[model samples]
Target: MRWAILRELAKGQSLPVVEIAKRLRTAPSAISKHFSVLYHSHIVNNEHGRYRIAPGLLSADRQSLDFGCFLIRLDRLPK
Candidate 1:
Protein backbone atom coordinates (compact mmCIF):
# COMPACT_ATOMS: atom_id res chain seq x y z
CA MET A 1 0.00 0.00 0.00
CA ARG A 2 2.86 2.32 0.74
CA TRP A 3 4.37 1.45 -2.60
CA ALA A 4 1.11 2.33 -4.27
CA ILE A 5 1.01 5.60 -2.43
CA LEU A 6 4.55 6.33 -3.49
CA ARG A 7 3.64 5.58 -7.07
CA GLU A 8 0.89 8.15 -6.98
CA LEU A 9 3.21 10.69 -5.42
CA ALA A 10 5.93 9.97 -7.96
CA LYS A 11 3.78 11.70 -10.51
CA GLY A 12 5.17 14.86 -8.94
CA GLN A 13 1.90 16.16 -7.56
CA SER A 14 1.15 17.06 -3.98
CA LEU A 15 -2.02 15.34 -2.87
CA PRO A 16 -4.19 15.20 0.21
CA VAL A 17 -5.19 12.03 2.04
CA VAL A 18 -8.66 12.13 0.53
CA GLU A 19 -7.27 12.33 -3.00
CA ILE A 20 -4.74 9.58 -2.43
CA ALA A 21 -7.42 7.37 -0.86
CA LYS A 22 -9.76 7.95 -3.78
CA ARG A 23 -7.02 7.11 -6.26
CA LEU A 24 -6.11 3.92 -4.43
CA ARG A 25 -9.69 2.98 -3.71
CA THR A 26 -8.99 2.82 -0.01
CA ALA A 27 -10.01 4.66 3.11
CA PRO A 28 -8.61 8.09 3.88
CA SER A 29 -7.76 6.99 7.41
CA ALA A 30 -5.69 4.15 6.04
CA ILE A 31 -3.90 6.53 3.71
CA SER A 32 -3.21 8.84 6.61
CA LYS A 33 -1.62 6.00 8.54
CA HIS A 34 0.69 5.25 5.65
CA PHE A 35 1.46 8.93 5.22
CA SER A 36 2.40 9.17 8.87
CA VAL A 37 5.02 6.50 8.48
CA LEU A 38 6.38 7.95 5.26
CA TYR A 39 6.35 11.43 6.67
CA HIS A 40 8.37 10.54 9.75
CA SER A 41 10.82 8.58 7.64
CA HIS A 42 11.40 11.69 5.52
CA ILE A 43 10.28 9.86 2.43
CA VAL A 44 7.36 12.21 1.91
CA ASN A 45 6.69 15.86 2.59
CA ASN A 46 3.52 17.28 4.06
CA GLU A 47 2.34 20.82 3.64
CA HIS A 48 -1.10 22.00 4.62
CA GLY A 49 -2.44 18.44 4.41
CA ARG A 50 -0.99 17.70 0.98
CA TYR A 51 1.79 15.13 0.49
CA ARG A 52 4.46 14.47 -2.09
CA ILE A 53 7.70 12.59 -2.48
CA ALA A 54 10.47 14.54 -0.82
CA PRO A 55 12.60 16.55 -3.20
CA GLY A 56 15.84 14.97 -4.54
CA LEU A 57 14.58 11.46 -3.87
CA LEU A 58 13.05 10.81 -7.26
CA SER A 59 15.35 9.58 -10.01
CA ALA A 60 15.91 11.62 -13.15
CA ASP A 61 13.81 9.21 -15.21
CA ARG A 62 11.03 9.28 -12.64
CA GLN A 63 10.86 5.49 -12.74
CA SER A 64 12.22 4.89 -9.26
CA LEU A 65 12.99 6.49 -5.91
CA ASP A 66 16.61 6.59 -4.85
CA PHE A 67 16.82 6.13 -1.11
CA GLY A 68 20.63 6.11 -0.94
CA CYS A 69 20.87 2.45 0.17
CA PHE A 70 17.96 1.12 -1.83
CA LEU A 71 15.85 1.87 -4.87
CA ILE A 72 12.07 1.60 -5.21
CA ARG A 73 11.10 1.05 -8.82
CA LEU A 74 7.80 2.54 -9.90
CA ASP A 75 7.60 1.35 -13.50
CA ARG A 76 5.74 -1.85 -12.64
CA LEU A 77 3.05 -0.34 -10.51
CA PRO A 78 -0.43 -1.36 -11.69
CA LYS A 79 -2.70 1.24 -13.11
Candidate 2:
Protein backbone atom coordinates (compact mmCIF):
# COMPACT_ATOMS: atom_id res chain seq x y z
CA MET A 1 0.00 0.00 0.00
CA ARG A 2 2.86 2.35 0.79
CA TRP A 3 4.50 1.43 -2.44
CA ALA A 4 1.31 2.23 -4.28
CA ILE A 5 1.16 5.59 -2.60
CA LEU A 6 4.77 6.27 -3.41
CA ARG A 7 4.19 5.29 -7.00
CA GLU A 8 1.44 7.82 -7.31
CA LEU A 9 3.47 10.54 -5.63
CA ALA A 10 6.46 9.74 -7.79
CA LYS A 11 4.87 11.89 -10.42
CA GLY A 12 6.18 14.79 -8.31
CA GLN A 13 2.75 15.93 -7.28
CA SER A 14 1.55 16.61 -3.78
CA LEU A 15 -1.86 15.14 -3.01
CA PRO A 16 -4.34 15.16 -0.19
CA VAL A 17 -5.39 12.03 1.70
CA VAL A 18 -8.77 11.88 0.00
CA GLU A 19 -7.22 12.00 -3.45
CA ILE A 20 -4.71 9.34 -2.56
CA ALA A 21 -7.41 7.09 -1.19
CA LYS A 22 -9.53 7.56 -4.26
CA ARG A 23 -6.63 6.59 -6.53
CA LEU A 24 -5.88 3.54 -4.44
CA ARG A 25 -9.50 2.44 -4.18
CA THR A 26 -9.34 2.56 -0.42
CA ALA A 27 -10.89 4.64 2.34
CA PRO A 28 -9.21 7.86 3.50
CA SER A 29 -9.01 6.61 7.05
CA ALA A 30 -7.10 3.56 5.90
CA ILE A 31 -4.40 5.67 4.32
CA SER A 32 -4.18 8.14 7.16
CA LYS A 33 -2.36 5.61 9.30
CA HIS A 34 0.17 5.02 6.58
CA PHE A 35 0.57 8.76 6.16
CA SER A 36 1.28 9.16 9.82
CA VAL A 37 4.11 6.65 9.73
CA LEU A 38 5.49 8.09 6.54
CA TYR A 39 5.36 11.61 7.89
CA HIS A 40 7.12 10.68 11.08
CA SER A 41 9.79 8.75 9.24
CA HIS A 42 10.51 11.73 7.00
CA ILE A 43 9.71 9.65 3.97
CA VAL A 44 7.05 12.15 2.97
CA ASN A 45 6.43 15.77 3.71
CA ASN A 46 3.06 17.19 4.69
CA GLU A 47 2.10 20.71 3.72
CA HIS A 48 -1.34 22.21 4.14
CA GLY A 49 -2.68 18.68 4.47
CA ARG A 50 -1.05 17.51 1.25
CA TYR A 51 1.78 14.99 1.11
CA ARG A 52 4.72 14.46 -1.18
CA ILE A 53 8.00 12.61 -1.19
CA ALA A 54 10.78 14.44 0.58
CA PRO A 55 12.94 16.59 -1.61
CA GLY A 56 16.38 15.34 -2.75
CA LEU A 57 15.37 11.80 -1.90
CA LEU A 58 14.38 10.71 -5.37
CA SER A 59 17.15 9.84 -7.76
CA ALA A 60 18.07 12.29 -10.50
CA ASP A 61 16.74 9.90 -13.11
CA ARG A 62 13.51 9.57 -11.18
CA GLN A 63 13.67 5.80 -11.43
CA SER A 64 13.96 5.14 -7.71
CA LEU A 65 13.71 6.60 -4.23
CA ASP A 66 16.59 6.44 -1.77
CA PHE A 67 15.27 5.68 1.66
CA GLY A 68 18.84 5.75 3.09
CA CYS A 69 18.34 2.04 3.85
CA PHE A 70 16.88 0.72 0.63
CA LEU A 71 16.05 1.75 -2.90
CA ILE A 72 12.53 1.45 -4.26
CA ARG A 73 12.49 1.31 -8.02
CA LEU A 74 9.36 2.97 -9.26
CA ASP A 75 8.98 0.85 -12.39
CA ARG A 76 8.88 -2.36 -10.38
CA LEU A 77 5.73 -1.36 -8.53
CA PRO A 78 2.16 -2.07 -9.67
CA LYS A 79 0.44 0.80 -11.38
Candidate 3:
Protein backbone atom coordinates (compact mmCIF):
# COMPACT_ATOMS: atom_id res chain seq x y z
CA MET A 1 0.00 0.00 0.00
CA ARG A 2 2.88 2.30 0.74
CA TRP A 3 4.42 1.46 -2.60
CA ALA A 4 1.12 2.22 -4.30
CA ILE A 5 0.98 5.64 -2.69
CA LEU A 6 4.58 6.31 -3.53
CA ARG A 7 4.01 5.35 -7.17
CA GLU A 8 0.98 7.62 -7.37
CA LEU A 9 2.97 10.51 -5.95
CA ALA A 10 5.76 9.72 -8.38
CA LYS A 11 3.39 10.45 -11.26
CA GLY A 12 2.47 13.82 -9.86
CA GLN A 13 4.74 16.84 -10.25
CA SER A 14 4.68 17.10 -6.44
CA LEU A 15 2.13 16.59 -3.67
CA PRO A 16 1.48 17.74 -0.14
CA VAL A 17 0.91 15.09 2.54
CA VAL A 18 -2.72 16.13 3.03
CA GLU A 19 -3.42 15.88 -0.68
CA ILE A 20 -1.78 12.48 -0.85
CA ALA A 21 -3.92 11.21 2.01
CA LYS A 22 -7.07 12.44 0.26
CA ARG A 23 -6.16 10.79 -3.02
CA LEU A 24 -5.24 7.52 -1.32
CA ARG A 25 -8.46 7.54 0.75
CA THR A 26 -6.42 7.02 3.88
CA ALA A 27 -5.69 8.95 7.05
CA PRO A 28 -2.92 11.52 7.19
CA SER A 29 -1.24 9.54 9.94
CA ALA A 30 -1.24 6.44 7.76
CA ILE A 31 0.25 8.42 4.95
CA SER A 32 2.84 9.81 7.28
CA LYS A 33 3.79 6.32 8.42
CA HIS A 34 4.26 5.11 4.87
CA PHE A 35 6.08 8.31 3.99
CA SER A 36 8.49 7.60 6.81
CA VAL A 37 9.13 4.13 5.41
CA LEU A 38 9.72 5.50 1.94
CA TYR A 39 11.96 8.20 3.30
CA HIS A 40 14.03 5.66 5.18
CA SER A 41 14.29 3.49 2.08
CA HIS A 42 15.39 6.57 0.11
CA ILE A 43 12.66 5.89 -2.44
CA VAL A 44 10.83 9.18 -1.91
CA ASN A 45 11.99 12.51 -0.57
CA ASN A 46 10.41 15.36 1.31
CA GLU A 47 11.04 18.84 -0.03
CA HIS A 48 9.75 21.71 2.02
CA GLY A 49 6.12 20.60 2.47
CA ARG A 50 5.81 18.50 -0.67
CA TYR A 51 6.97 14.99 -1.58
CA ARG A 52 8.79 13.85 -4.68
CA ILE A 53 10.68 10.79 -5.91
CA ALA A 54 14.27 10.72 -4.77
CA PRO A 55 16.79 11.48 -7.49
CA GLY A 56 19.26 8.90 -6.17
CA LEU A 57 16.77 6.04 -6.59
CA LEU A 58 17.63 5.85 -10.26
CA SER A 59 21.05 4.56 -9.30
CA ALA A 60 19.34 1.20 -8.75
CA ASP A 61 18.84 0.75 -12.47
CA ARG A 62 18.26 -3.00 -12.27
CA GLN A 63 15.57 -2.66 -9.66
CA SER A 64 13.85 0.11 -11.59
CA LEU A 65 13.91 -1.97 -14.74
CA ASP A 66 12.45 -4.92 -12.85
CA PHE A 67 9.67 -2.79 -11.44
CA GLY A 68 8.88 -1.44 -14.93
CA CYS A 69 8.64 -4.95 -16.26
CA PHE A 70 6.40 -5.97 -13.38
CA LEU A 71 4.10 -3.01 -14.02
CA ILE A 72 3.85 -3.95 -17.67
CA ARG A 73 2.79 -7.46 -16.73
CA LEU A 74 0.35 -6.21 -14.17
CA ASP A 75 -1.19 -3.82 -16.68
CA ARG A 76 -1.80 -6.69 -19.06
CA LEU A 77 -3.91 -8.52 -16.49
CA PRO A 78 -7.72 -8.27 -16.49
CA LYS A 79 -8.91 -5.45 -14.30
Candidate 4:
Protein backbone atom coordinates (compact mmCIF):
# COMPACT_ATOMS: atom_id res chain seq x y z
CA MET A 1 0.00 0.00 0.00
CA ARG A 2 2.81 2.34 0.92
CA TRP A 3 4.71 1.27 -2.17
CA ALA A 4 1.73 2.32 -4.22
CA ILE A 5 1.67 5.68 -2.53
CA LEU A 6 5.39 6.10 -3.15
CA ARG A 7 5.03 5.19 -6.79
CA GLU A 8 2.13 7.51 -7.36
CA LEU A 9 3.66 10.39 -5.51
CA ALA A 10 6.94 9.91 -7.35
CA LYS A 11 5.43 11.79 -10.27
CA GLY A 12 6.40 15.01 -8.53
CA GLN A 13 2.91 16.34 -8.14
CA SER A 14 0.49 16.75 -5.28
CA LEU A 15 -2.69 14.67 -5.15
CA PRO A 16 -5.91 14.79 -3.22
CA VAL A 17 -7.26 11.76 -1.36
CA VAL A 18 -9.95 10.89 -3.89
CA GLU A 19 -7.57 10.98 -6.86
CA ILE A 20 -5.00 8.93 -5.01
CA ALA A 21 -7.58 6.31 -4.20
CA LYS A 22 -8.70 6.22 -7.82
CA ARG A 23 -5.19 5.80 -9.15
CA LEU A 24 -4.47 3.04 -6.68
CA ARG A 25 -7.78 1.24 -7.35
CA THR A 26 -8.83 1.21 -3.72
CA ALA A 27 -11.46 2.78 -1.54
CA PRO A 28 -10.77 6.16 0.04
CA SER A 29 -10.94 4.68 3.52
CA ALA A 30 -8.64 1.86 2.55
CA ILE A 31 -5.84 4.24 1.59
CA SER A 32 -6.57 6.79 4.28
CA LYS A 33 -4.74 4.73 6.89
CA HIS A 34 -1.59 4.77 4.77
CA PHE A 35 -1.98 8.47 4.05
CA SER A 36 -2.32 9.30 7.73
CA VAL A 37 0.71 7.29 8.73
CA LEU A 38 2.80 8.54 5.84
CA TYR A 39 1.83 12.09 6.57
CA HIS A 40 2.61 11.78 10.27
CA SER A 41 5.87 9.95 9.59
CA HIS A 42 7.11 12.81 7.43
CA ILE A 43 7.00 10.68 4.36
CA VAL A 44 4.17 12.79 3.00
CA ASN A 45 2.74 16.21 3.56
CA ASN A 46 -0.73 17.65 3.39
CA GLU A 47 -1.63 21.10 2.22
CA HIS A 48 -5.13 22.31 1.44
CA GLY A 49 -6.22 18.69 1.86
CA ARG A 50 -3.85 17.47 -0.86
CA TYR A 51 -0.71 15.42 -0.36
CA ARG A 52 2.79 15.40 -1.75
CA ILE A 53 6.01 13.66 -0.89
CA ALA A 54 7.94 15.53 1.74
CA PRO A 55 11.08 17.12 0.29
CA GLY A 56 13.22 16.01 3.22
CA LEU A 57 12.28 12.39 2.68
CA LEU A 58 13.07 12.65 -1.01
CA SER A 59 16.60 13.85 -0.24
CA ALA A 60 17.31 11.64 2.75
CA ASP A 61 18.09 8.00 3.08
CA ARG A 62 15.79 5.72 5.07
CA GLN A 63 16.27 2.73 7.31
CA SER A 64 13.86 0.07 8.43
CA LEU A 65 13.10 -0.42 12.10
CA ASP A 66 12.33 -3.94 13.14
CA PHE A 67 10.24 -2.60 15.97
CA GLY A 68 8.49 0.56 17.09
CA CYS A 69 7.77 1.77 13.58
CA PHE A 70 6.04 4.78 15.00
CA LEU A 71 9.51 6.12 15.67
CA ILE A 72 11.22 7.96 12.80
CA ARG A 73 14.66 9.51 12.74
CA LEU A 74 16.71 11.68 10.45
CA ASP A 75 20.42 12.71 10.50
CA ARG A 76 21.46 9.11 11.14
CA LEU A 77 23.67 7.15 8.77
CA PRO A 78 23.25 3.45 8.25
CA LYS A 79 26.20 1.23 9.05
lDDT of each: 0.92, 0.91, 0.65, 0.71
Candidate 4 residue pairs in backbone clash: none
lDDT tens digits, residue span 1-79, model 4:
7777766776677999899999988999988889999888777889998998876555333432222334333224231
lDDT of 4 at 11: 67
TM-score of 3: 0.67
Model 4 TM:
0.70
Tell me the tens digit of each residue's lDDT in model 1 across 1-79.
Answer: 9989998898888999999999999999999999999999999999999999999999988799988898878997665
Indicate the residue-level lDDT of 63 in model 3: 26
The TM-score values for the models, in the order shown, are 0.91, 0.88, 0.67, 0.70
Candidate 2: regions farther than 4 A off: none
Sorting all predicted structures by lDDT, with the top scorer first, yields 1, 2, 4, 3
Clashing pairs in 2: none
Q: Model 4 — which ten-residue stretch has the worst lDDT?
A: 59-68
**Model 1: lDDT of residue 71:** 84
Show the lowest summed lDDT stretch of 10 residues, model 3.
Answer: 70-79
Report residue 28 deviation for candidate 4 (angstroms): 0.5
**Model 1 TM-score on a 0 to 1 scale:** 0.91
- Tens digits of per-residue lDDT for model 2, 8-29: 8888889999999999999999
Highest TM-score scorer:
1
Candidate 2 minimal-lDDT segment of 10 residues: 60-69
